[model samples]
Target: MKNPCVAHRGWSSRAPENTMAAIRLALADPLIEWIEIDVHLSKDHVPMVIHDYTLRRTTDGKGDVKKKTAAELAALDAGNWFSQKYQGEHIPTLAQVIKESVGHCKLNIELKTDGIRYPLIEQKVLECIQAYQAESEVVITSFHEGTLYRMKRLCSQIRTGIIIDGWRNSLPKELKELGADFLSISYSKLNKERVELLKNAGIQIMAWTINEKRAIRKIAALDPELLICTNYPERWHELRAESMELEVVNRKK
Candidate 1:
């Protein structure tokens, strides 16, 4: 199967990461089968789509995102830092994202709770997914192994993945114990051998945030099931077209 391209935080390279603008842009791209987004629970237990735990970086607001209610978060300007064209874009709720993207593309929701804990976050996320009837269209991932475990226990039908920055010697074993469906790793840490190992163990691999042509070619050669990229789904489409052309030429020769 041709590797699918997942737009990281929507078409984040062009729009404010995690804003509705980016999500809409990614959904419009036929090449983007999956849109990956980060989520943090607001004080009111609403799942707001934003990368950092703090609002200072991505929004006009200052302080921890947990301190703000969903309504307050909804009013913050999430797009001005990226460019003037996106001046008033607001952070979207998970429900809003799912409603917009259900039939258009799959969602890869990363639970951003590495250092902090949001009690019952897994349940809240699941409720949103169930409400939208998007069970088949969503994959929940996290660096927190405990969260994945809790997610599986809560809903065995939900597909889950583990996100890692670097190679882990015990990943295969942990995945089996955790019942994880796949592994999403930093593209810089991937190699053919590692890919083969995971594939042999019946685990799917996804490489993230890769944009350079050379890096894309290298990772593409490994044939990961998903290639997560920011702002450049077209580049992967181009590479796939070239690969198909090469195959056709070889057959003719």
Candidate 2:
């Protein structure tokens, strides 16, 4: 099967990250099979699409996002910081994201919990995915192994990915117990030896935040099952073609 190419945090290169515009742009691209997004609950327990715990980085507002209601978050200008063209984009809810990309692109929801709220996060995320009937296309990912464990019990059918920021040999064992389908880790955390080690263990590996072309080529040579990149989805067609051609030539032997 052709390896899946997921847009890290949506088509973040063109639009504000985690906003509806970024997601819409990602879906419009034919190369991306999945678009990854981050989720955090608002003060009222509504799931909103965002990457950070604080709104100061991505929006006009300045405070903990969890402390703000959906209405307060909506009133902030999420786009102005990126550029003036996107002057009024509001923070999107998880429901809105799922509804818009239901059939257009697969969803990779990364749970960003500020507290020990795994149960609520799992329930709310699954509820949203189920409401949109996006179970087959949605994959839940988290840096926390506990969250992955909680998610598996809630919905066995949904695929789960474990996020790692550091190197560890014991990850495969943990992933197996959690029933994780994939491993999503930072690009710096990957090496040729590590890639082969995980691949041999029947785990899919995906590296994140890789925007440089040379880095992409090097990682492509290592042959990960998926590449969750921030700025390279547009070039996926080219990269995939090169990889496939190499595979074909090698198969002739």
Residue-wise lDDT of candidate 2 within 1-253, one digit each (tens)? 2556778778888888988888888888877888889999888888899999899999999988888998898899999899999999999999999998888888879999633853488888899999989999888888887888888888899899888789889988888888986888998888888988888888877788777766777776677465656566766667668778988999999
Residue clash pairs of candidate 2: none
lDDT of each: 0.87, 0.83
- What TM-score against the true fold does each predicted structure earn? 0.94, 0.89
Clashing pairs in 1: none
Model 1 Cα shift for residue 248 (angstroms): 3.9
Whose lDDT is greatest here?
Answer: 1
| lDDT of model 2, residue 246 | 86
